[model samples]
Target: MTRRSTGATTMPPAPTIPKIPPAEVLGRLAALQTLPTPALKEMWRQLFGREPLIFNRPYLQSRLAYRIQELAYGGLKPETRARLEALGEQLDGGNVVLRRIRADSRPLPGTRLVREYDGIQHVVTVRADDFEFEGRPYRSLSAIARHITGTRWNGWTFFGLKGRPEA
Candidate 1:
């Protein structure tokens, strides 16, 4: 019996990143400012492994500079990330636009929130994406709160998920 080989396929090697000494990291960061926009974008692609959300040079340079240092050192700690999220929420003031932009702080589905307004008890059931109030679907707790109180409100505070922002 005889066998014939058609072809052999091989994957390309992954790009190897050269190690930069911690002290040289500062120089590398400074050099980023001198590179052209296209070069900077290519560097961003190489470092981040994805296209930047924004094409602004200053934004790219700042992020790339941080990434360079982060690679040599380390990124933010878990506690730092948590603290930033908390601060973001605090500053967000339950603004719907800001809420949509930042992290999702919604509670788990199947949770029930009870609040009394005008001497009547209101119940809201949390869903995966939206909420159910008075047997109707609502997009945000603020919307439900408005329906109940006839005024604007921060949904998280309204549901006791978060306390009212300090004045």
Candidate 2:
């Protein structure tokens, strides 16, 4: 009986990144800020392993350059990172905060919200701290909605201010 052995192959070692001079690093970072939005986004993906949440060109460029510098010069100290995390948690309630649906939905003061319900046209004037409907000040749009419909309703929904809920 005879036995045969397969040959073993050696893999090449990973390439090493040369230490760039500080001046060159600064120059590179400066150059990054002039890149277009799409290019910056590509760089962001390469550096961060994910797409950027912001689409603004200047902001993207700045953040990507900062990230590049951070990687080369080392990141924040553990204590600084922990402090930042704690601050972020406090601001964000320890979870991902959803964008407000009504962030820009509210009408400016003196602007009017009009709705035709039950063959009657209702007009609501946006005020500094409250809404005015029929010369009556109301704290909430829901209150106005209740006044109009005699039932509990989301004022924004009733006035066609809110978009359809995502399924």
Candidate 3:
């Protein structure tokens, strides 16, 4: 395209990577699994420019294979990475510690939990940070379960939010 100000023509940017042969990529991927631990670690250092943190054989192999393919082909798009980061933030509220933990099974606020105990129905309303059972606030479902059954129980299992443990 020609620039109006400078009256000079310029070419568009070239592709970041050249297309690689499928067979070459496949051969490199297949070779990763057969490599010894030392060779794999060396390849990891060469590809990633850093020492492998985990040092697990399978992890090294898989990551090496992925790096090979990524170099041959391409990596994730910027938009995809941004979307993944946004999703992680939403799931953990940007808390690093919470991100490593499993997501809790708390129902959305205003959800009504219904359970029948001794032929009488019980209802618990889920709030943002607490629960309401019989118009009274409860810190945990287990507390409400203990109040009903007079015994300690897993709140999630008691209210059927989670599966019961097998004997």
On TM-score, the candidate that comes out on top is 3
TM-score of 3: 0.51
In model 1, what lDDT does residue 51 have? 75
lDDT of every model, 2 decimals: 0.81, 0.75, 0.79
TM-score of each: 0.45, 0.41, 0.51
Tens-place lDDT digits, model 2, residues 74-119: 7799999999778766644566442132233556568898999999
* lDDT tens per residue, model 3, 1-167: 97577666787854343344666898888888788899998887777767789889989988888888888778899999999989889867888666654345566668888888899899999887788998899999899999888999887788888863211
The alpha-carbon deviation from the true structure for residue 111 of candidate 2, after best TM-score superposition, in angstroms, is 1.1
> Candidate 1: misplaced stretches above 4 Å?
1-20, 93-96, 99-167
In candidate 1, what are the lDDT values of residues 1-167, reduced to their tens digit?
89887788787876665445799897888888799989999888788777778889999999989888888888899999999778766757747576654445666569899999899999999886789998999998899999999999988888787853311
Candidate closer to the true structure by lDDT (higher is better), 2 or 3: 3
> Which candidate gets the maximum lDDT versus the true structure?
1
Q: Model 2 TM-score? A: 0.41
Superposed by TM-score, candidate 2 places the C-alpha of residue 12 at a distance from the truth, in angstroms, of 28
Clashing pairs in 2: none
**TM-score between model 1 and native:** 0.45
Off by over 4 Å in 3: 1-22, 103-167
